[model samples]
Target: MDNDIKNFFKEIRKLDDNIDIPAFEEINIKRNSPRKEYYALVGIAASFLIVFSLFFTDEKVQTETNDTDYVITLSDENTTNTESLILEESSIYSWEAPSESLINNFND
Candidate 1:
């Protein structure tokens, strides 16, 4: 396994050495246009104008009063029925080993 991996890497290195790589070239970047800057300034001014108008505008919030009234009445007839209920006692369970006759019955 080690010899196979070493031979594979040696082949890759020989192939890499045989290939010709190109030289690096310089890249030229142009400056930003004045029209784009003007548009950005106009957009910023429009956003600021919108924010200031929202803060300074006079807006009246009208609240309506609820005229309907609600009344709740509780009765004492439903509170006197808990004394007639009956409850059963719970049974306790214990584990027991099986008998030798029960095991012999299964074997037959």
Candidate 2:
């Protein structure tokens, strides 16, 4: 085994050194990272859309025309009030507070 390994390495070392390796070209694809302001704007827009839809959505319940004496209803308008209350409660939570320097220099 030792002789075989030595023979293999000697064979490799004795190989011609005139072989040329191809140069690799660098790839330069420009990557666009999302900005903080863009994310904030998108978040604000989505929140407004959700709130608007919740506030303006119709509270009507549709009944099936089948003769089976079973009617399925989501809730008796109680869920709507509960959802609104939840949204109101969640409004108390906010993003990180502004930097102290920004707060102090608000007039500037």
Candidate 3:
């Protein structure tokens, strides 16, 4: 075990001495200033539009909901409309009530 350890260390030292490290190279990564500025403006506009739409939708929904009478009126109108529809489409099956003579015959 000791002989193997010494040989491993000797080989490692020789490899380190023979190995050469490569020089550092800079990557020339570039961004167009106009494109960066345009993207920033687009992000700002998108955020503004989202906020504006939220406010607009909230206002519209409030206008619809603020009038409690309209909701009540609509509910009342719907109930009456449904009732009228039921009455209009209703069918009645009529039959004459059985007389006492009919009962007497069944007993006989």
The TM-scores of all predictions, comma-separated, are 0.29, 0.23, 0.34
The list of candidate 3 runs beyond 4 A from truth reads 1-32, 69-108
Tell me the TM-score of model 1.
0.29
Considering summed lDDT, which 10 consecutive residues are worst modelled in model 3? 81-90
lDDT of 2 by residue, 1-108 (tens): 699999988888778456665554435554555687788889999999998877665332122324344768776766565444344443435745659678779967
Model 2, CA-based lDDT: 0.66
Per-residue C-alpha lDDT of model 1 across residues 1-108, encoded as one tens digit per residue: 699999999999999997877644434455679999999999999999998877656332111122233445666767865675666555455534458679889999
State which candidate, 1 or 3, has the greater TM-score: 3
Alpha-carbon RMSD of each model: 24.9, 29.9, 12.7
Weakest 10 consecutive residues, lDDT, candidate 2?
A: 58-67
Quote the RMSD, in angstroms, for model 1. 24.9
| Ranking of predictions according to TM-score | 3, 1, 2
